[model samples]
Target: MDKLTIIKIIHTVIWVFFNVVLFYLLYSVLINKIDKWVWICIGLILMEGLVLLLFKRMCPITVIARKYSDSTKDNFDIFLPNWLAKHNKLIYTTFFVPILILLIYRLISG
Candidate 1:
């Protein structure tokens, strides 16, 4: 009901969505032959674990969420800017960067 609660909910939702998307993309690229439902479940579990690790490791999103949650306290209208909204870009890139490099290396070697 309060602003902070609303902001926290929104932040959590966004983070969860981003995690799911990232996992789905990576799974599709690396495990395209797998069953969709099984991959989905695996991705969900992996993402949840990654989120918890991020939170424990002081990841930027977790840090921002903590700060916003603390600052808003009881506010609900917290709006994140584009940069913050794209905060997980680095994480996603980490998943793809090596793949890209490997592809490039194969092409060059061949």
Candidate 2:
């Protein structure tokens, strides 16, 4: 592929890898409790949301991708404002609703 495509792939891979490692650490080490799995799951989901928001808004890799796309005339669009991109209320609600419900159920049942 071209330089732009290569850069985009690298950026995506790095972000995914970072998130996986971060979640692993959080679940395995930071909150080491069987009962905390619910909290861990919720935290991971929220972290994913935050990463999505960052990718949409102020991610350095996304900024680089935007620059490369602009220079090469690629069809990548990454020019979202920080507020709209990072704090997408709809996405946040959609992702967390199920997790919140599960957490509440677990708490009440247990």
Candidate 3:
């Protein structure tokens, strides 16, 4: 397979991994299950946020994928629907921020 395709697959996998982490975190919060796993998920998400900030809000894999393709689509480096790829960050952040706030509430109220 081509390098761009490989990057796209890898990026898609990473995206899915984060989705699982975020959802699990939400579940943990909902159930008041504050544990190491919750902290781990928060750490992983923060690390990803730091990496994106360092890269000027772009995934490093996306930057590498640019070396192999000239596509102007938002999903040029990921295997996702075009609209999803274009708004993925916005969509996830919308859910994520609320999950985080809820988590904080659970922690403080308990």
Candidate 4:
């Protein structure tokens, strides 16, 4: 397989992994199951956030993918649809921020 295809597969896998983590976090908040895993999920997401900040808000994988493909479309580097690729951060952050806030409330109110 070509480098660009490989990178797209890897990036999509990473995206799905984070989606699972985020969903797990949401489930924890909904069910009031605050545990070590919840903290771990938050840590993982925060680390991803830090990486984005360091990379000027682009996924490092996407930056690497640029070397292999010249496509300017948002989903050029990954398997997501164009609109989702364009607004992925906004969509995920909408779910994450509130889940985070509720988790914090659960932690503090205990």
lDDT of each: 0.53, 0.52, 0.93, 0.95
| TM-score of each candidate structure, all chains considered together | 0.38, 0.42, 0.97, 0.97
- Superposed on all Cα atoms, model 3 deviates from the true structure by an RMSD in Å of 0.7
Q: Write the per-residue lDDT of candidate 3 for residues 5-78, one digit (tens) a residue.
A: 88899999999999999999999999999999999999999999899899998889989999998889998899
Off by over 4 Å in 3: none
lDDT of 4 by residue, 67-107 (tens): 99889999998999999999999999998999989988988
> TM-score order of candidates, best first?
3, 4, 2, 1
- Scored against the true structure, residue 14 in model 4 reaches a CA lDDT of 97
Which is the winner by lDDT between candidate 3 and candidate 4? 4
RMSD of each: 11.1, 8.0, 0.7, 0.7
Steric clash pairs (candidate 4): none
TM-score of model 2 relative to the true fold? 0.42
Runs with alpha carbons beyond 4 Å of true place in candidate 2: 10-38, 48-59, 71-93
Model 4 ranges with Cα > 4 A deviation: none
lDDT (10s digit) by residue, model 2, range 8-55: 677556545544644554444333333555456557666766875877
Best by lDDT: 4
- Cα deviation at 81, candidate 2, in Å, is 21
Worst 10 residues of 4 by lDDT: 100-109
